[model samples]
Target: MQSTVNYLWHTDDLLGQGATASVYKARNKKSGELVAVKVFNTASYLRPREVQGREFEVLRKLNHPNIVKLFAVEETGNSRQKVLVMEYCSSGSLLSVLESPEHSFGLPEEEFLVVLRCVAAGMNHLRENGIVHRDIKPGNIMRLVGGEGQSIYKLTDFGAARELDDDEQFVSVYGTEEYLHPDMYERAVLRKPQQKAFGVTVDLWSTGVTLYHAATGSLPFVPFGGPRRNKEIMYRIITEKPAGAIAGTQKRENGPLEWSYTLPITCQLSMGLQSQLVPILANILEVEQAKCWGFDQFFAETSDILQRVVVHVFSLSQVVLHHIYIHVHNTVAIFLEAVYEQTSVAPQHQEYLFEGHCSVLKPNLSAKHIAHTTASSPLILFSIANETPKGLAFRDPALDIPKFVPKVDLQADYNTAKGVLGAGYQALRLARALLAGQELTLRGLHWFLEVLQATCKRTLEVTRVALLFLSSSLGTERLSDMAEVRGTQELRRATELRTQLRALAEVLSRCSHNITEAQMSMGHLSSELAKNRDQVHEDRSIQQIQCCLDKMYVTYKQFRKSRMRPGLGYNEEQIHKLDKVNFSHLAKRLLKVFQEECVQKYQASLVTHGKRMREVHDTRNHLRQVGYSVATCSTKAQEAQENLSKILDQLSHQLLQDRAEGAEASLLPVTPYPIPAPTDLVLHMQELYEEMKLVAFDLQDNNRIIEGLNRVPSAPDV
Candidate 1:
């Protein structure tokens, strides 16, 4: 490849190439600014001078953000070839992005939307300036990363573009074969003779094809053989089939063609977006020029879609209770306004937490930013203003009853009760076993007695604390009162509480008795072990300590209802509900009511809204079909009128010929026939188009209603 385009630009890298020109990434000699230089080949210059300069003129006239800007025109230093310096898009062409493995199925919904808006806006600008882009494909659209890290798509490669009015016609066939109109494809690719003139609607066809490829990662029409290999079959498919009737075809060797009409499951666009997109594709992808949508209608519909908000599921207390449809451009404050409308919680009182994030969303942050951060899960909104909203007032009647006893400090009680029995038993066991069968010296015996007395004192202190804890916690006053209540649930709870208290008290009493017996035997064991006279006292002390451990273990086993414990077994800290706040039962009741009032109602409303949205989608689709029928009828009607006029002219010419031959006397009087115009059919088509627009508007309005509903606040979790 050539290393330099001109003395002014160093063309070390080739960006892309087309039949007419090759684009290169170049740097200015003086400024060092990176730019793309489009250098036309000798064949391009061989075309008419007007055709060669049209792209430069078109780019110079356009100054829109969505359209690529032209910098300057220069001549290559080597061949003196024309070079167009244009804006360098750092992110490359959209076609390059789509070819990546991640986007093999299609551009993700967000990226696709960006392409849709940019292309629509750029084409709208072109229409306003009476310019037609004969070629509109992903390869011709460039992508740039904006300062805020957003993707911006811009229309580029306007070589096939030209200034053409709506009524004016051009016979030139120029565009990629797959995105070309059938008339253009027949003449340009298949090398077929053509007399049909192309209007601005041809651009619409290309735009639709481009959008379909962007959405689905494939062309709308394809045969067993590719477009180039089977050009005649491709032409037949484009002309014979209705728009969107068949998406693509697949066939095995010598097998029948399998046609797919619906988008594949791999398509990433949501059903809601697809519903809006399908009608637009249907109207613009029409093969017949008369049935296709004009740029004005196309702009109107696309702008409407861009303006509409994206729907996001909002969850409260981990339960999905609402769907928020706020525009991505809207700030968190505006989103809060929508939330307020649904939840009746003021903006100041609402705290929005995105999934996997602890920090609440800032009020000034854009919804688009939030969407990017929390793309994996629904946003969770907590209402700090209302614990309970109106119309969902519910209080457990059982909670109204006054507490019959003071609340127990569970942590304090559990700490006191933990080592009461275990410590006493350990002390007695150690003293008897370690000194067994050995005569203790006077000093050793004294030391053993002292340790025993200290152990006894500590055991008493712990026992006192444990007894106090049990008496305060397991009092019968509350349980007795609850048992007298008429409600079955209350009565059952009271019985359970009574049984637990009784079992605990019995075990503590037995363990305390055994400990007291063991303490008394410790003195006897000291005398016997010191004199080395008998093992009787040592065995008795061991037996008393063992009995205490056994009692504690049995009680623990009964409490746990499992045999997974070792040693003295496990002890669970009992939670005494001494106050009227029965949180466990109250939580269950509140959850039930919450389900009935909030979750279930929201679900029902969602179902209804979904049905309505589908209805509107169907209505828009029907309206598009009606518009197609009307356009076709109008075209036929105009053709018939033209044919009638020709017939009349031929008849008049024949009469003149006869008169010239001196046979006028033999001819009968002629009658003038009335011919109908296609004005009514055209009017009907306009009406249907208007109806489709109205349906689109209504669908947007309904989306707002579906995003929010009057309902209860989220119930607090226990």
Candidate 2:
């Protein structure tokens, strides 16, 4: 071997052979510094010229600390082996933990934060540099005992990653099966008889699965009679089912009366562990992916949900119920919003995945009980929208009273008060007071607490709408269909969904009203993003972002476009990014430009068009007056006189003239970007500016009426 730098290593001890390359634990010949060396299979690599060079370019540019550093590559003209030297891990891969029984106590909650932070930091850096780590999995993650809890962790392997921040879009089959997302099926030539996409999101899925295994003692989707034997495990893993009453997920505790299925997990484990894991994986893995949380947002959403409603959904009548409307609405909004963000930020193939599922178009679920969002009490439906601006809206649908004794599944224990069961509740005090002498003091106290609690919960739920509004949202086709129809079915469905959702809007709007003046006073930096998505063009980065999205989608659909695989939108988060949508992005750009330029002074165009219309109307009236005068006098030559009168009226009105009638030859000059009038043309391009404003003012009431009367329809009539 040729002599090189002291840190360089030379070794032939092959650690493992992947489909593309053989990895060797190497060491520097001079410095004795250890490194992992990956040598590509000479025969296979030679056949894929683009992938080979692309990987080289992508890895060469990487410099993040969390990522496994690639030091150098060596190739000789005569030798068939091409090797890449990378950082080596001593404690071994995360896969070691999954395969080991004693790995239960491998990482504590606080300790895991370090690994997560490192991964996030690396991902942030890569995204900043426009590189996506396309393959994230347990095998690729390595942990070392740097702190008390084996805290130190690093992400290895960027072999399947891409740099679509540029104009290029690559469509290739890639990624491992355990973390493979359904949309990935589109681009993937699934080595097995399964469907998958080989996109950046696959890395996130793998990371999520890895994290789940790390956090819990078991795989989220356990093999019921192993996949190698029964195929159910294979199906479950492939299909990406919810944790669905699994060992680590569901538990039954015997209370004084009976036992109930209790929720005892994190928010990431919500909507089935698969959905939770998929989004987390996307955030950690996809470089250009949408931001899910900062430390605060993640824990706020996670802790609040797991502790109260999101996970276990404890205390419907007392705590969770008081905010059940908010919880349900916000849950729907957040889930939908997450989906939108996912679709927007995801790599092409895995955009719509929340769990392992793609965003399958399911019919809208009908809520048996009307969800009352007004702050009165929890769990119980209160404050129905009995009347709407559309004249008393749909008569309150008969709410199927859920058969219950108002018993909530509290996580707390009454024997010693350890579960979510609250002995400190004031409602029970008020109830006892009512049962005895009906003390006004206790009733007043309960009322105050009830209203205060409802108000707070209402605020939280309502703000959720803002977040949902932040996204392009889901089932837009339903909205479109609702807008055009007048049938009973359309009205009924539209009224219900709109009322339920608007009850969502009311929550946000009310919350905004009560937000402390201090918070309202701050110079919100996020206002930059808030500049109406309609006028998002000011963000110069949008086009670049859209370009990357287009490429991702293309890469995701590579297999299918070539008849290799198939898919729809995502099922993970069950939403789509309007920005990621090709037409939507383009339309938004045009709408922004149109608003800023054409519509900014759009009142002028309205004036111009309206003025022209009025002139035509006035001319017809004058011509009619003239024709009436002309009609009276010449009775002997009535036919000729009438013909002449008609000609004169046509000339005066100009309606039957050169502009509207193509056949009429005009002596006037023709200009496409016409200065409609000669004098105005000479003055300058000034008058047409107010057109949009004029149109807006005139149409404002019409718009208000339409919006007031129209409601967004359900996904489908169930």
Candidate 3:
């Protein structure tokens, strides 16, 4: 056990422990900065000094962006407690992330790719230095957290690293048993030192196994069987392959309760990604070491997919990087290989010589002075080459094609193709009409001409005046060659056919030019209609129209995909973006149809409301008239009653006067005044009562109609 009394480095905390070492989260007393001190467990590990020495030497010579840095080493106490101080990685090892049951399936495929690329880069660096990391697993890969959601992965644990001579291999086996290559197992089984030994290929196999474990929570070749598990795993490594295909199948039970929208199915890799990873695993896991890929071959084969990753390298820097384009994808390895071939600089020297700065522009040259430089900013250049030394514009031998080839304009090509399709369709329609003996309309002819003109403009722009002469000349030339063998009858038929073809071609060419302006006008109209439809405000009607449009877009995309074949030469990305045939026209039509439907429904409701409103108005008018008539009749009846009363009272008073002078009135005949009978007045009063009853009945009916109108709800406002 290591004693803490004489320790040079102050071990603040224990980070992790292994069979041979105990890694501590420590503080350097002199520097007063945090660091990771991996103390050797002297009692557990045999030849601890040898392992410690090898690690120290490997770490001392190796300095890479994707490899952990070694700060210092110390040996103290009677136990010879040796400690290797290294840069502290805040985020910890990749194994911790991969092993966490909570997030095992939640880990993203992109994160796996990132980790793989970093390890590959680091391995490539190590291989260039003639060193092999016998052990490569998730446990040895550290993650460095950075600002702005960026991270840097680094290869750690160089305890098993060994520098070898050219094509050298070690007879003794080392590293985690589960990750041991088949060749390592075979050699161990043979128990022979003269046989082919294990080399860098073993490390690659280990890397493959590590990736498999990280991607899926389970090991590809399960290591089981208590004490004999290691032995069984080794035997299986030599004999058995992983079950299922490259990425393996995913079970729902293996994942969290729910997956994030951005992630793919749990533990399942995309085909594009699998295409890159499968080969690496397949080759590295081969029984024959020679068949396995070197770092160069591995990187080149995977660059197309692996290069999709964007890494940010940052430090204390104020300079803003502008217009950086990363054109390098495993090109640095190619450059180094070229340098080793043409120049005296060793591959190891070239590695240190070409340490890259992310921001600065690398100059173009053959092979300039090479020196180490560090990244100054978190810049991921997609179209720039920073890994190559400045002024060394060495083209990668692996990349036969140009790096920055322009993408084909599939959208424009598709549009041009539609014109041809329209013409063919119109021509077919015309032919059918002729066969049916039907008269063609002017509009039909106009459409046929416009479509044909547009098609010809894009596809066949041959000179019209020259076409006739060329056609005749070609026919005549053919006839001259067959003149001696053929009779005049055949010659005449050939000449007629050629003449008809030439005439048709001439007519089409002329018509195309004549209708060019009309086609342009139609195209303009279509564009404007599309624009108007797009700008329409989104209401329920518009939303319904948009749903139709979305369906159309999806159908068009599927149709395009179905039509695409090997030799089509269409850019899939661009062609996918193009709308289907007459999509914009369809969109405009959809908007028009939906809007018209809404308006018609609204108008119908308004018309119905108008009818109801008129009924209410008429009922109101009748009620007012009835009220006026009733008031007028009532006043007339009162006046009649008053007049009758006055007449009766006058008669009574005159009679009294007559009684007082009864003798005077005896001579005069007692003729009564012509006054109407009381029966007549009673009849008039009865007629008035009947008329009031009728008026009341009409008023009550009108009031009921008004109440019904009030109860009906008005239509919703547009």
Candidate 4:
């Protein structure tokens, strides 16, 4: 039957019916706009006048995206019944969605997050206005499809809502029995003879139940029988069970009662997400009123989760889908690392396509940008490549060393060697005048040789052990191929260890080589001094030795000014300053540069290449599928094939144009043949290049140290 309200709205379609009122889909007669007309039944008018008018006042005051909007309040033309004209939602309530067969277990994680965000936002708006919704459940929440086909949930049916501050309390027994707090359930459902005022936290209990139902497709605190059938037992269970324990209880027709303390196996949420959500549920679902979280805390926690959670859909071969969960604050580098951990695909080999376009994956790319790009089309094509694409190469500042061998001053090096020999000759004479005599000098030289030999021997042993372990970890089958190095955490640690050990070995080897001639000269002078230990005039011998030392010092000063091989030699002042250099600080800066310039840049290139390859692979597979379907002679198939063919033709034309514009094209054999996998020679070459750069950096660092050493003054010429 058609009805008219205030001669402005004409109602014909029934939307829903409840205990107090019935809603109908209506249209405004003047402008023909669709709306929902809610008419209160006569029985509802029996309540207090203030209670009867509260819904209208509350609805009128709300203006949030997650709350239903009120248009007007009027009376029926014939019977004078009160009617509320409000914004209409084309889709039904959340209860209807949960009732679908596919959602028998629960709403998927994506849909559940949407429901959670919307409900939390709507309730936050209510609290901001000092309003309390006594009823919060799936049936009271309405769903509507937005312009972009996204499901938007809105809180509706505010008949039981009223202005109540957080500190204030009301003694009304008005809420669904199953979702009521233990205090409310005892008084309202079991008819306990007591007066208990409900605080704002009562709403939190109902919201917890609603979210639990939306996530798990069942109410929490279920008894063997239904809540109404065994009301006393249900009350006992709700009151006696500790907070966050007892997820639910169930019983078959003739089986034993079973209790579960965790989410069921059928739930689609990942463990990472569940870890975050369980705490929120624990806090809000507290049976102890004092321990329960307030709306402020709830809002803060939910808002934080919304800011950090990002769900991406990755597809391998368009058959299987992986729902990857990540955080919004993660960078592209961290995101790729997470992907590698989960999928076992090296960051260098992964390719992806987002929204039918190839993405340029840069290491510093923000997760926010990635989430935005995939918002409309979340399905990303993923693939693996046998080799890196040429276009994927990126410029790294660490690899920009000039291509020239450092020059050496052979003549100046010879002079420095000769001066050192002459210094040794004068040192034997000076030892006779010394108070400690030749014994102390001989002991110092012996100690120096022992320490140097021990250091060199220990370094060699450690290097050999490290090489053995590295070779064993990487089997002999691919000894030189780094492409087979899985991007695992263990492998990365091992690689770092190898680099450090190799550098230490090289340093020890060079020091041992440079000091050999000096050691030999010192040994010869020590033997000669021991053989001729005659008592000489102390003052005269000291003066003669000092003059020889002065001459040798002058020769070294000239040698220090000339260009020489890095780490070749150092003067007395340079050696003294070397002990004061802050080596740890310099090492930290070098590590920072390597990470930012080399590792991150390479990861970015891998992601870009992977995405492009995925695009091409997907397009080709789609074309093949459409062509096969055309054999069925179906009209839809024929149209799809035709469209795909046109796209392929355009791509061919574009390729030709590119070739004409000076892009080189590779030709493939016409006949089908088995193709061999490409060797990892390029990967090895890259590794070599990185090692060379590290060596160059070390040499430059040594040069700087030498410069600092020269700035310090040597002792005045004797």
Candidate maximizing lDDT: 1
**Looking at model 2, which ten-residue stretch has the lowest summed lDDT?**
389-398
- How many residue pairs clash per model? 0, 48, 10, 4
How would the candidate models be sorted by TM-score, starting from the highest?
Answer: 4, 1, 3, 2
Alpha-carbon deviation at 57 in model 1, angstroms: 1.3
lDDT of 2 at 389: 12
- Determine which window of 10 residues in candidate 1 has minimal summed lDDT: 709-718
Please write out the lDDT profile of model 1 over residues 1-718, one tens digit for every residue.
Answer: 4424332543557899888898988877767888888989988988999999999999999989999999888886678888898999999998888754335456777788999999999988998898999998889999999999999999999999999999999998899999999899989988889799999999888888888888876788776667677776677677876655535453443344454555655566755467668888888878887788888899988887888676553433222334455677789888778767766677765645443343356789987776542223445454433232121112222222222224333333222222222233323323332223121122223243344344444434444443444354332543343234323453455455445544544544554564465556655645644553243233343444454445544433332332233323123323233111232233234334434533344344334333423433343233323223222322332333333233333443554566689875444333243212234423433443344344333333332222221122331221
Off by over 4 Å in 2: 1-12, 76-80, 104-106, 145-150, 165-170, 185-199, 227-718
Cα lDDT tens digits, model 2, 1-718, are 3223333333446565677877777778766888877777756566567767776787788877677788888753345467778888777776765444223322433344455566656665666677767676677777666656545667776677778553333456567654544345323523354342233344445555556556543444434443244333344343443322222211222211111122223211223333433444334322222332333343343433333222211111111111221243343434333433322311121111112122221224322222222222212211111111111011110121111112211111111111111111111221221122111112222332233333333333333333244122222343333234323453445444444444433443443444332123221312321332224224333344344334433422432232222323454112222212432343344334433433333233234323322433343233222222211211212222233233323332342344466743343334343323323322221222132123223333332322222221211111
**C-alpha root-mean-square deviation, each candidate:** 42.6, 29.5, 38.3, 39.2
Question: What tens digits encode model 3's per-residue C-alpha lDDT throughout 1-718?
Answer: 3334323443456777777787877765555677788888765457655665798899998999899999778765667667787889988888777644223342455677678778878988898888998878878899987687766789998877889744787876777666667666555543435465666667877887787776554455543332133554335434544422232222232321211111123343433354456666666655555566776777676565565432221110111111111235434444445334433344343211112221222334222222222222222221111121111111221121112114334444333333322222222222222211111111122232233333334322322322332343333443343333333454455555445445544543554354354345545544543443343322245445455545554544554454454433347544543544345455445545433644443334334323423433343233333323322332332333334333333433443455577643452233344323334534543554454344334434433332332222332211
Tell me the TM-score of model 1: 0.47
Query: Candidate 2 overall Cα lDDT vs. reference?
Result: 0.38
Candidate 3 regions with alpha-carbon error over 4 angstroms:
1-12, 48-52, 77-80, 186-196, 223-234, 242-265, 308-718
TM-score of each: 0.47, 0.35, 0.40, 0.48
